[model samples]
Target: MAIPTTNRAVVATASGPVDVLTDTELDVPTPGPLDLLVEVRAVSVNPVDVKLRGGALPGGDGPQVLGYDAAGVVLAVGDQVSAYAVGDEVYYAGSISRPGSNQQFQLVDEKVAGRKPASLDFAEAAALPLTTITAWETLFERWRLGADSTGTLLVMGAAGGVGSIMVQLARQLTGLTVIAAVGRPESREWVRELGAHHVVDRTDLLAEVTAIVPRGVDFVLSPFSAGMVETYTQVMALGGSVVAIDEPEGVDTLPLKWKSQGWHWEFMFSRVIHDPESTAHRELLDEVSRLVDAGTLRSTLGTRLSPIDAATLQEAHRLLESSATIGKVVLAAG
Candidate 1:
């Protein structure tokens, strides 16, 4: 198949609102030495995509792409690429520094991309990469919790994209008891079905959680960071660790000092932005793919929108910003 010189993409012309995302045509991106040029099949909307669209983050002089998670087929590979070749199916959460996956074609580093799971389709596979990377890094890397570690893990905002996968990974891979905090009745069941050992309402978080485990949890994964530092400190065991993926206004670390507790932040793009030698995403995604194919892990895709375009992407962004979405919302290319 001949690769086209130009491709269709959803470009954020000027960051402000969802209207900033415009469907436009641009030249296909050329891969760097360690890059793979992929024909994007499906893409998922993430909070970072909305943040980039809302002018919270910096944008380039020209229109900027905003998607992070994608599944696609390799159209070409650069000189140094060896892990993948043309025609291989792959999925990845790409670098924040580069052009994103809200396009018909994308350029991603070979070290960050992984083989797509054969058991899932493009949209299903696309939904897993970013959330899986975030969950895996938060659990095993940032928290440094091993499979043999035993204790209760309290996950705040447990039905969202990253939390959904985090609950499953912690339950399936670790001996820690999973305690998920969600507000809605449906979300409670959702987290329970995903393998949470206990479900507590966020409205009465401290009491409900303490009722289940009087001693306090050993680990806390917080995706919604607003007003959570004090609550987490009160509910954590001595020497426990808290990993947050959201940016709160500010956290009072003074309270954590008394308990000798540690606080860590997990950003999936850190490896791609800060470290050139980071191949952990590749290894992580490969392992996730194997787990998915083996049925030990499952895709967290909750909604699907048709025919990747500006209008569909706008709807996806709206859905994500509403804070009511349970899992990932994916857009399938026509």
Candidate 2:
């Protein structure tokens, strides 16, 4: 089938709250030779979108589309698109430099897109892409944890979107013990149910974590940084590493110097932006899809907003801004 030439989208006219978002028509983006045209069914919001929409970006402006994660059906393949065909259900967290998934039709590099899990709906599938990519890449690629390696992994902010999937992926895919750090009582149980071996409250983070891992954890991952590099440094075993998705809380690297500690930053959109070693992300998504299909990975959709409209998406953004959302928030098109 021929690809459409225009699309409906929610666009940000200027950086601010969700009120900046408006429904608009845009020229349908054409796929590059290596890209594919996706008929978007659902999209998930992340803090990164908030950052860009709020003018945190260096020089970003104009009517920016803010969604990163998406689940959709492939409508048309670019000339070089060899991995997928039209009508294939797919999911992806697109590049930060390009237009994102907040549109009815979007262009994405085929190399970074994965087949959606057959068992999940578009909303559930959308919830997995960005967080799953961040968690999976951070654990396996950055921290070097393997399926056969046995060690305890401390997950900070463990009830959030990425952490929810991180808990399940750690429990199901790796031999490592999963230590989930959550603040509230309900969040603790939530992580525990998702397969965390131990759940600690962030109110007294180091003490609670040490109580669970007397010898310290082998690795620590923070979904939202709150001086975690320094605070969690002591909770990691000697030679252990810390990885963060968000900016750290002004930590001094000196504390980690003696331990030869490694710090990593996971940005899932890097592949899509720079196109550096792009196929690696596609492979990662493939692996995540397999894990999901095998029931080893779970989507982290905590809230669902309908019809992918401006007002509903605004509410989703508001909920995320509250900083208490437990899991991924999704906007699904009817």
Candidate 3:
């Protein structure tokens, strides 16, 4: 299929509320060397999208296209592109430096994109990239956990998107004891279904976690770590590490010093944008594709919406902001 001259996009008029997101048309971008001009078929909403759209996070002037996760078919490839062809199906959590996947046609770097899993459709594949990359980098890259590594991995917000994949990956790939902590009792069973070794209450972090692991947890993937650093320090094992996907601002690392514990942040785009030659995102997604195809992991897509547009996107963003939905929310681009 040929690329359209003008492609549909939902652009934010300004960095404010959800109403800023409006339907618009954009010119199809020309592929550069090492670029894949993808025909975006599916997209997934994320908390970052909400943050950027709602002025919680600052972006460039005027309206901006907001998306991270996408599954699409390659319409064309740049002359220098080597790994993918015109018809190849690919998935990626695109670079924050570029225009996002909220458009019909978009260009993504070949090194950052991966082959979509054959067992999953575009929507399912779309749900994986952003959250998968975040979780994989947090567990494997940031924490430096290997296949042979064995310890207690505490997924602080285990029912959410990143934690969902992190729990499954830790269970399937590593020899670690995975403890999925949910804020509510209702989410306990959901986390168990994702193969968490233990489902504990995240609300009662200190008492509940201590009851289960008397020695304290070895690693923690915390979603909200701003004011809980002291409590987390108590729950962590000696020399253990904690990683947060969200802003860990206002957090004093002093408490961790006594225990020789560490607190780190994991943003998936950092490696791709800063280190241009990095192939970690693609490699992670490729391994994730193999895992999904082999029935080792499952798609975390929870609510599937339809016909990618401003209204659908606004709803998706709203849902993510509520923090009530479990797993991921994906929108079909048809």
- TM-scores vs. true structure, each candidate: 0.97, 0.94, 0.97
Locate the minimum summed-lDDT window of 10 residues in model 2.
54-63
As a whole number from 0 to 100, the lDDT of residue 25 in candidate 2 is: 93
Clash pairs, candidate 3, are none
lDDT of 2 by residue, 44-111 (tens): 99988887777764347667777889999998888988999989999998877688889999998888
Q: Which predicted model would earn the best lDDT?
A: 1
The models' CA-based lDDT, in order, is: 0.90, 0.84, 0.89
**How many residue pairs clash in all the candidates, one count each?**
0, 1, 0
**For candidate 3, lDDT tens digit of each residue in 210-244?**
98899899999988877888988899999989898
Q: Summing lDDT over every window of 10 consecutive residues in candidate 1, give the lowest-scoring window.
A: 55-64
| Clash pairs detected, candidate 1 | none
Task: Arrange candidates by lDDT, descending.
Answer: 1, 3, 2
What lDDT is reached at residue 181 by model 1? 93
Query: Candidate 3, 238: how far from true, in Å?
Result: 1.4
